[model samples]
Target: MTEPPRTVQSYIDQTPAWPDGTPTDFIPMTAMQWRIWLLAPAGKFFEGLVVFMTGVALPLIVKDFGLSPAEKGIVSAAPLAGIMVGALALGGLADIYGRHRMFVIEMVVFALFLTGLTWSPTYLWLVVYLFGVGLALGCDYPTAHLVISESIASKDRGKLVLSAFAFQAIGALVRTVVGFLILANLPRSGRGAGYMPPRSCRPSCWSWAGSRSATAGIG
Candidate 1:
């Protein structure tokens, strides 16, 4: 027969309980606990999805608007600028107001900026929109990191952080594929318009449809 395990209360009672506790390095979790850990960072799903969509649509925006490379760089940099500001500003506020509240605020701001992006008329307007997006992204990055870290057990921290970060890579790949698809479909009505004979490339067809809808303004 297997021996029964001693209760922790009994064990603690027997030991020397230091008034100023000696901090230990080790933490432990069971196999089942470890398995449950796999789901703890699922909040990243929403964050990852948003990031993937933004990255995917960026190239399409450049193509549709016929922006110069400098403009593309500037537009792309706007979000980055927002990120820097958001990290410095929102990060501290998030720490003060709590993670959940900041998360909600961040997501709302992201949605607003994304909607704005769809309607942006001028390059400057798009850049301004992207600036907000960057700020939201900055707020989310640390907030999500901290949330996943604090929620998971010490033993599972490594796995949780790694899993959350790994989602970034997945998001990037998804964005890349979507970008290629969008570009492939959009009308190639640029300087090279006559070079490639248009035989209804997939992206071009979608772009044509999109243009017609834009002209019609069908909500």
Candidate 2:
């Protein structure tokens, strides 16, 4: 016998305690679903994190390094250009190589590039790192959604995919606030007004030069 469809009132009457929410309501997620949900958004989070952070940091980086217009343009475009290249050239490889392997590989590459970005010794290296970071993020963009969409219920796919993508906005907003706070409070000792590469990675020679420059400027 065919099942009867529910009335509008029946749908409205539902609540979470009604023996676990139905698909139309707060749909119950499986353990695998939960993991994919949490993990998928991470790609967008990093996309927003690095993209906004780089854009924000660019001014300070330029001021500190005294970049010309052409050099500045290249630095500005490197990551974005990488995103396009990666999506076109590398994203499709997930089909042949398998999504799981591609996902892990991309994230590993992202981490390495992110670490290198912090330790960038010169303009060329900085651009290279940024491009790599973007490339990794680009590769993850399609794979993450595919993983989530393929693994979840058809009813829940739209909600999960949208929520996962929203992380980019959240990441952008959070990083913007963080960048503002750091800029507002950082001690202005020479190059301190500019971006400070993390202490562990800061080059001693450059650090000394920045310090010396700051002292001279202060005087």
| Number of the top-ranking candidate, with lDDT as the measure | 2
Q: Give all candidates' CA lDDT scores.
A: 0.59, 0.71
lDDT of 1 by residue, 18-48 (tens): 4688655544444754544444333344334
Q: Please, what's the RMSD in Å of model 2?
A: 9.4
RMSD of each: 10.2, 9.4
**Candidate 1 minimal-lDDT segment of 10 residues:** 210-219
Top TM-score model: 2
Stretches off by above 4 angstroms in model 1 are: 1-69, 188-219
- Per-residue lDDT tens digits for candidate 2, residues 1-219, read 998998643443444355453434554666876987887667788777677777767766775567899988988888888888888888888899998899888888887777666667788887898899789888888889888877776667788898897998987886687667656654455654544544343443233322332232223
Candidate 1 accuracy as lDDT? 0.59
lDDT of 2: 0.71
